[model samples]
Target chain A: MKNFSRFTLLSLLFLYLFFGNCIVGNFSSVYAQDDWKQEYSSVCAKTQNAMILTPEELKSYIDRCDKLLALINELEGEQAATEKKVYTKRVKMCRELYQFALEYKEHK
Target chain B: MAPIQKLLSAFIIALTVPVSASAADYSHYLRHIPPAENFGQVVLDNYSHKAGVLPVTFDHWLHRAKFTCRLCHIDIGFAMKAEMTEISAADNMSGYYCGACHDGKRVFDGRNIFGSCAENYTEDEGKRCARCHSSAEAEERKYDYKSFSEKLPKLPGNLIDWEKAESEGKVKLTDFLEGVSYKREPLKAQDDFTIKIRSWDVIFSHRKHTVWNGCELCHPMIFPSTKRGTTKYSMFQIMMKGEYCGVCHTSVAFSVWLCAKCHITLVE
Candidate 1:
């Protein structure tokens, strides 16, 4: 009876640790994804608001796109087909937009 | 007993819980270059194959060499999409669609052009039907795209640098058609503006686009010119082969991949 109770206790403790770690890991990943999405939305809004961008505004825009591109690259491997497409598109847009900004600044 | 039951239920739940998993393979359609002769050619098979008729092959390179895009797409009221116009034998016979130019009465280069798709034809006349109905392999074209493009000045890519050719007076595009287009005072093009798309500023050149397209070509059709910010378009939509800019950029004109062309501005 004592051995059975000890086994039960060890099993319960092992399950608690295992499931606890899993839940924490899942929550953290979800949180990280939400943060990345918020950052993307904020940068996209700022970009759209600027009609004729000043040099500083353009630089900020380029910087944001670069940051977003990095995040997209990091997330792309884990993404589904549809999510990967969206990320790939964002990456292209970011790269092109960054290049455009650099050229405009040089010409200006 | 209750504690053991709870542990068993918990293990079962853990094992059955769904994980965020997906198949890793992902791909997007990339445009491929067709042979010079077949570059702008399209095979219309909407109702043709269903009705047991061979698909109609329309060549943009052949027609665009003689007439402007506006002449066929705007003035003649042909839809940008193939087979969307629902062209019929009766419609052509009534001097509409292809009949407008292919009536045989219309003189081109001081010679009468042959009539197209007549309803009634003798065995001898039926032989002429093969000219258009012929498959891509069987068609004997009068003009060669390579020879025609070679005579004009060269561009970087395989496609003809139409904008440069037009600017250098190598090719002159006619904007009007008799009995089709109405004469009106041309509106002055709007000043160029920088459209902020994502983190980049794309310089929208009104003067450059208007040179070949004119007002009617884009107005109220591909774009609504009457209102500002009324139509919202995205690069994602364009990349997905949606309308607006992709109509020309993906197929005929310089591709969207050439970033420096439109996105001329830079950040200091």
Candidate 2:
């Protein structure tokens, strides 16, 4: 009984330290960082640079890229598809870049 | 009461007290955040923490005197946060970001606005770096917010109106880049629409937003690619925190008390 009481006292003390007034809120908890979105934008910029199309020309090129991406996604889902994971990731990147391009236009 | 029961009650009381005290502490922190030196300074801190340094300061107060917020934030493609959009000095020099307005021949700064970049690089042009990197301590603020904003045509009707002066053409913002944004076709703006709120019935207007932020200010980052609801946010979180709307709402744009701006309905 004495040991049980002692263990209970230790556990209560531990709980007080862990979740009590020890940790104060800092900037990180106050803000949410969107790492996923930042990575997406970076990937998009790299994929589109190879073509080097003018602003007007870039739109049509991006549209075609979007169609190609949808086709690739459809192919990947089929029963006998053999596309590599890298290829699938690249297609996803292209579609995201195309959307970013459209967003650029809307902003303009 | 037995010893065990007495201890249990003490623990429960201890837990409740801290939670209540912590909430009060956060509320106090929100009330005490310092005002920034300038709007650009505030924007830079918010932007840099989120992304990185912008190619330039991109002053709203200076630019809005001649142009409207719609001209650049909408038409020119400047994001609200720096580095979110890939802005290069090369792009600006070619009339992309600051180049559209700073072009030496047509648009000049004060009276001598020049092209985005130099035709030739000068060997000793270190002094000119402060033009965009005005965040350095040496730079002096040209306009005082209180005096400058006092005479603004569109003075804010609410607690703090960050965009009121800029919206009324009291500030001139440049949109065309001498080289990058070569195409200068006039834009016929679409009529303002009421973006339906999902969880609440608050209707956000495109017209009011255009006064402070053009389309590019939000776009795919805050809103997203497809027409989907923005991530859920709470008033308590935004007022005392940072995020999409909180970026401005808590800082310069408006005070936290103006709940009607977003949350239209009040629950009794």
Candidate 3:
């Protein structure tokens, strides 16, 4: 009976360590992916507001986009297809916003 | 078999676990070399390519040859990083940032040079737009770097010896602008100090830097004027974070490959 209790306790401990770590790791990874998407969206919003900015101010915003792009690149293989598409779209929007700011005239 | 042994075994396993496979090799970053013409050139494309306009290729060598680094970076508020400055067409036209000097009226020598990104450009004048907006492949540079630098005395590296050029009175740096700059008495620069590192001592020269970059360039921004040694920095931070000496030394001022320049004092 003592041996049975000892074996059962060991099994429970093993299960806790193995399954708990997997669950925690998976949750963190998902959380990080979501965080990246939110970050990209935030940068996109900033890029949209490029019209009112000076040349130097616009450059800093574009730099933020570049940094996000770098982060997305690091998550290349691990990223979900949907997430990848969203990131790509955000990057494109940022580029377009930057281009628009370049030739943007106040009068015409 | 005991709980202590089991815990010890787990700890050993954790310690033995392999690190990340994608660990970056920092050596490659330290060894990067920029092309001759493209050395200090930064592509400002915050919105150009997106707006169907070509990215503005700003060559530092071209500008630095004529003006001081402090003029644009400090006074004009140009960011050190390329594409980091959000310059728009309207901003330049109002005689701010690039427009401050690039205005056609600003005299360089005796010529009334054409204005930068002129708003009311004629059909014939439209062709001149490509002068600044030239792509990587289609650059139409008026001054050849090699030919221009040839007359100047040679330095150890491929870069033009800017310090020597300044010392010889070849390049006269203008510190103050008429409307833009608030004139004040230049602060008496502190004497050169030596900072000790592992087996080497770095001699920091304030005199050489103050010639082109006034106190405003480094003080209170890159390095605090409050007190010396208060801000803690490391070589890793300088190389990675692009702080301290890494700001200019890595790309424009001089390549970090010239180790002997700073790491002069060697311990036995």
Candidate 4:
């Protein structure tokens, strides 16, 4: 009886350990994804107004894009590949846009 | 004395005769214009064939008729060229890309916009799959470009006069999405500028372009330099080689063949 009870406890503990990690992992990933998405959206959203930004401001944006791109590339999971590709392309485009504005400002 | 008089008359005639740019000859620059329905249509086969379905056909005309260029390119982050987006069924079901709008629950034009990808659809629901995957059936499509475009303003060639249609309130373009796009101040368009060449001086309008493109579409991607006269490309480049203005005009816009549209001021 004691052995059977111990087995039940062991099985319950095993299931809890397995699913608990999964649930926690999934929630952490969701928050991580939201963090990067928010960063990406905020960074790329400024591209339309790039022309009006100062050269210093444009340079700063370029730095932000590069950093965000790195974060996107470092991501891993089921949807990581698609998310990485999407965010990488967008962040690079944003970086290029900022660089273009910086060059225009410097020339003037 | 007669010979000199003839020369003077010829010079006078040349000066008086307005340099009439061939308006109807926009087709000269195009290899072949797609039929009105096929215009701006792109079929993406990224993972469709791998997943045992026909390629998805995205008709830009229908989408652009309702949404602004910035909403997709800037807000949603859709790549400009074909197959560059690499969309997947999983991505759509997870609420990215096409899922942003076609979430099945969202209503448009008084009806629910069809969802892009679902978790599990039976074989009987193949009709729903065929909507975007392309069944080659006309009835499956909700919107018909021919009848819809018939009411809109016509350009010189097969293209629709989208600018006129929007300006006259025939079509109201939506520039914002609820969650995807950040709410911000409307763009303040710069004034018009003239690009002087040896032959025709082109009159470029920022206000007109901003209405459709919202600045980022051309800036940095098409035109690296925003300043006046900094970025230079000749007619040889645009018309013959398909560069600069030819990029959009050749494929989607009014086209580079319509010379009078841009080269309004003649240099001679």
Candidate 5:
């Protein structure tokens, strides 16, 4: 009786772990992308205001763009192709503009 | 005229125009200039035909006459290529792009600019919709290109001398929009530099171009490289093909046939 109880407890524990991971993975696929999409929108949204940014601020965004670009590049599957292309170009445009602003602030 | 027709005309000119035997024969690079009425007309039809509405005939001169190029291109996030922006009516109705100005609440020149789009419209509002979605050959236009160009300085091909028009303040350009644009220090003007060509080294004026383009329009996109001598441009690319300076000069800014404008070193 003691052995049966222990065996049942172990099986339940394994089952819980398996189902929990499946639920979490599914949730991540749906919700995880929103975080980056929001981040991208906010990051690139400030292009109109770039000239007003301080050198430090510009540098931070440039760094942020580079980091986002790296993670975005690592995104796999054909579904990610459009996102990868659009995001990569948008990020690069924002990054280059930020870099240009930094240089302008320093030189001019 | 359509972009296709422009290309065909340029090709025909390239074939017919006599190749210059000497440096002075700049006629080799001349292109056919569209008349004033049709010069800068852009048809926005990305979703128009499918939506059962006529394509919006966007007159570049009408808008650019009052607003800076940067206002539309950078701040408004409009793509340079026509129909490339993929502007949907839904986007406009949400107070983005054209809706940024055309919200119908914002007062420009003490008159309310009509709202760009709406989810539903009464019979009266139908007229407002027709303002943009008019037929291609629609004669009823609030701003006629011919009358508008009359006061502005004229170029060889009857194009508006935009540089002169701005310099003289004949047309005052609004560079900043209230909510959409933020206040910032003006760009410290960059020095004019010469772009070397074989027959004539072109003296490119940064100060002149900056007035209309601001900084964002050209930098890192059209002319990506900051380093001098990095980007090589041939007349073949400029006159016959849409690359480098041809991006604007061939279509909007001025004709490359006005060689004396850029190739000023030899002419002077």
Candidate 6:
């Protein structure tokens, strides 16, 4: 009887380890990851509020950003020929504007 | 004495349980890739009550026939996993969710789509609701799996090969939904470039993605707007079934084994 008890305890321990590990892995796969809204501040909520735009407006924002990026890439090739400091400042401004459009799309 | 018998019984029960469960075919019906029927129906039935009614069904086969899965799941706004999206009737009624497609004028049966939301409810309206929530019904088994799938256009490769069909001009997705879209000129396609993978020498083609996904798919969601490199992802996670690129790779699209398509230069 005593031997049987010992065997029982050993079996339970093995079961616990095996089942416990499976459960942990399964749960992690199902819900372990997080999304942007959950991780980021409610600033996203604020951005979505008040203003409403059609899909066209949203696409236009994406287009504007792409054009800006293209222009920046083009200017980088000509940095030596152009006025150094002024061109650099203009590039920075364009990049910043591009980011604004990007953020607007996200917030939308 | 009595307690000892109880412990012994418990041990025997536990030992048998795993063996029995393992013998049962939990995934028997899901062997070969099931065609993209309204999989969301079964998915919602299995999980929705615990989650919410927003477990609205999204049929991939029907939509992919006309539009690419990338248009909705990738572009419009949808989570790859069923019941994961935080959908609401208000969102749909306000031109979100199912309303994105069900809008009355754009396509068929769009007006009656407002059934998901109404100030008052009745017994008859529940019938229309079953159009989506049909998994629990007795008639569900009536949908002959073989017959229904055979009727639908075979996906050529995976039942969800959106890019292949779209590039062939088989699918024409309406990027601009009337009443939903304001108005904007079409954006020019950017020259395709390789997104060099870290560690792995995989090359992701922007052109390939655009063929199916168009620009809207990747722009604000997967990569996010403006915050470059913010979304950290791993091939392992995707393989293990964390949606993203895996939603297709594991189930439908191309198997991950075709790594050379994405993964480039192998270190000699």
TM per candidate comes to 0.56, 0.46, 0.60, 0.79, 0.71, 0.47
lDDT of 5 at A65: 89
The Cα local distance difference test for each model comes to 0.58, 0.45, 0.63, 0.74, 0.74, 0.45
Candidate 6 CAPRI assessment class: incorrect
Q: How many residue pairs collide in each prediction?
A: 9, 22, 19, 0, 0, 2
State the RMSD for candidate 6: 27.0
Maximum-TM-score candidate: 4
* C-alpha DockQ of every model: 0.01, 0.02, 0.01, 0.27, 0.09, 0.02
Real contacts recovered, all predictions: 0.00, 0.02, 0.00, 0.25, 0.07, 0.04
- Estimate, for each residue in B177-243, the C-alpha lDDT of model 6 and write its tens digit: 4432223233444455545555446556655666555444444444443543445555545544434
Off by over 4 Å in 5: A1-58, A64-92, A99-108, B1-31
Q: Please, what are the lDDT tens digits per residue for candidate 2 over residues B173-211?
A: 555443323232223233454435444355666566644
Q: Least accurate stretch of 10 residues (summed lDDT) in model 6 chain B?
A: B23-32
Pick by lDDT: 1 or 4, better one: 4
| lDDT string, candidate 4, B226-247, tens digits | 5667665655456445567876
Candidate 4 Cα errors over 4 Å, as ranges: A1-33, B1-32, B135-137, B226-231, B234-242, B266-268
The best candidate in terms of lDDT: 4
- Of candidates 5 and 3, the better by lDDT: 5
Ranking by lDDT: 4, 5, 3, 1, 2, 6
Can you write out model 5's per-residue Cα lDDT over A64-108, one digit (the tens) per residue? Answer: 889889878877764465446545755677788888778767866
Q: For residues A8-78, what per-residue lDDT tens digits would candidate 3 score against the true structure?
A: 99999999999999999999888987777667656554432354567777677667778777777667452
Query: Model 5 over residues B28-58: C-alpha lDDT tens digits?
Result: 4434666766766778999989998888888
Model 5 accuracy (lDDT, Cα): 0.74
lDDT of 6 at B19: 39
True contacts kept of 2: 0.02
